[model samples]
Structures are given as C-alpha cells and as structure tokens.
Target: AIFSVGVSQLNASLAHRIPAREENILPTFRKALDLAREDADRLCHWISQDVSEDDFINWVTGSVRRMWGKKGNREVQAQFESDEGRRSVFDMLINLAGYSMKTKDILKQCDRVVEGAVLMRSLLKKVSHN
Candidate 1:
C-alpha cells in the first residue's frame, strides 16, 4: 500500500515533466511505470514475508539499476536517472521495507492480543456461571 502511494507520487512527478504531445515517449514511460509498480509490489511482499534485510536491499539495488538502466529509450532512461526519480527510488528502498515489516509485526501482535482477549472472555463467562 505504501509502495502504491509512492508509485502514484512518481507518476504525478513524471506526468508533470513529460509533455502531452510527446505521444511517442508516452508508451515507454507507461511501460516503465508499470514495471516500477510491479517491482515495488514484489519488494513489499518480500518484506512482509520476512525476507532478510540484506537480501531485500540487494534485490532493490539491482532492480533499480535494471529498471533505470541505459538500455531503454534515452529520454525515458534519463528521466528515471534524474534527481526526482532517484529520490523516489531511494525513499522506496529505505522506507518501504522497514515500514512494511513494522506494519506486519504490529498486525501480528494485534491479532494475538485479540485472540487472548477472546479466550479471556470465554473463561470469564464460565467462571461467572459457576
């Protein structure tokens, strides 16, 4: 979810910079955008599933390079290599994993607490009957 927000921000940032009449460039830009979102979702999944931090970071670094690498349309590639693009990627790498993991842990703890409360309530009802 956090990654989705980041992607939205990225899309908005890119949309503002790229001119509308550059229809030729838009396809490449859209493809890159789709790839980025997919990568972010995969990374988020890895984080929530308890992938090692070192492994996660390694994948992110490599993925960013591949995504923004020199092989694509020069204009598209240059856009991704720009400061705004780098910043967005950086934010995702630094914050996304940590935030996802923290959220997963918090949810787990909440579930356990709720389960305990339910058990306690059941026990209390039995005791009250006695």
Candidate 2:
C-alpha cells in the first residue's frame, strides 16, 4: 500500500515537473511517462518480494538495458526535439534505480549513475524554464 502510494506520488511529480519542450510533443511525452511509471511500479513489486539477489540484479540489468535499447538516433530524432525530452527519458531510468537491491555494491553504483541523471534532469529543467 505504501509502495503503491509512493509510486503514484512519483508519477504525479514527474508528470507535473517534466514539461514537454515543444507544444506538439506533450501527448507523446505523457504516454511515455505513464509507461515509465508502470515499469517502476513493477520493479518495486519485485523488490518487495523475497527474490534472490541474482534475480534482482538480472531483472534490473535487463530492464535498464531494454530502456537503453529503445533509445537511439532514430528514436530520438523521431520522438524528441529537445534536451528536456531526453531528460524525461532519464527520469524514468532514475525511478527504476530507486529500487532496493539485495546486493548493495553493484546497485549502489547504479544508483550513483541514476543520481547523476536526476541531477541532469533538474539542471535541464532549470535551463528550459529560463
């Protein structure tokens, strides 16, 4: 219940904070944002369970990789027009990185990377607004 609420809060926060850089891009951005929230919820559920460390690591790796694979020159050209759009994608990745991992060292490193992304997203938001 708490986790669900947290996920909802994050979804609301991200949706509210991350604006589409262009007028025509808002709807597509919302769709992608929703998908990212759903993925985070799913990842949180896995964390709540008594899954093995290996399984948790594997799942997170695969999930992040899938996200990475979806991003590229072609998709970026087609889907995003500004750096804010790119920041939105990383926001989703950061949401995933908030998951609790059985193995601390590896996930800690991953979290560090996500933290950088989160910071970049914030910086980009500031720049976009200005």
Candidate 3:
C-alpha cells in the first residue's frame, strides 16, 4: 500500500525530467517502453487508475541494478561521479513494456510458417500418390 504509492510518486516525479540529450539506444527502447507503458496504464485504468509500464519498468530495472551493486547506467559509468552522473543510464526495462521482435523479422517468420504449412501439405500429397 504505502510502498506502491511511494513508487508511483517516484515515477510521477521522474516523468517530468524526460532526458533530452538522448542516449544511443533510446530510440528503440523509448518507443517500446512508451507503448508498453501505455498498454499497462490502459490495463490498470479501472483499478485506482495510476500505473504505467514506464513506471513499472523503471522501478524494477532501477531497483534490480541498484541491488546488483552495478548501476549499469551509462551516465553513471561515464561521469564516474559528477553532477551529470545520472545521465549515463539507459532507462531500466524490468516491466519489459513494449516492442516485440522487429517487424522485418516477424514478417520473415510468418513467411517461414506459411512455407512450412505448404511443405507439409505437399508431403501429404506425395504419401497419397504412393
């Protein structure tokens, strides 16, 4: 109860910062996180109405990294320990919020599935001919 609220408040607070400098992998990661986060909020809209995938991912990712004694944040790594120390990290993705395999890969997979089905059917035809 209290913990949940504390985490929520932390996310709400972080949301405003929206790092502008852009990390190297932010494009794909941010997009996936945003989508996943949106879906999560939509899922939770009825129950207290204040949860997002972004929040969950950040919380989990940040917490896990902190626990491992390895921040894993690029910003933290780069600065070593300066004012910009926070900027080095790529947002943690514990929630696994968004992005499912790339589109091109998915299409190729679908194509393979179709090919497999066709091959199976052809195998049946050969068996019948024999």
After superposition, the stretches of candidate 2 with alpha carbons farther than 4 Å from their true spots are: 1-23, 51-130
TM-score of every candidate relative to the true structure: 0.24, 0.23, 0.20
Report the lDDT of model 2 for residue 32. 61
TM-score of 2: 0.23
Cα lDDT tens digits for candidate 3, 1-130: 1123333544554576555335534554555566667656744542232323343334334532443235333332223233322221122111111111223587755654554344334333333343
Residue 38 of model 3 has an lDDT of 64
**Which run of 10 residues does model 2 get worst, by summed lDDT?**
72-81
lDDT of 2 by residue, 15-106 (tens): 66666356635655566667667778876653343323343234334443344443322332332234332233243343434432323698
**lDDT tens digits by residue: candidate 1, 1-130:** 3444445655775677666556655665676678787887876654344323343334334433344343322422233344332223233333323322443578865654554344334333333343
At residue 80, candidate 1 shows an lDDT of 33
Model 1 clash number: 0
Q: In order, what lDDT does every prediction score?
A: 0.44, 0.44, 0.37
Evaluate model 1: give its TM-score: 0.24
User: Which 10 consecutive positions of candidate 3 have the poorest summed lDDT?
Assistant: 91-100
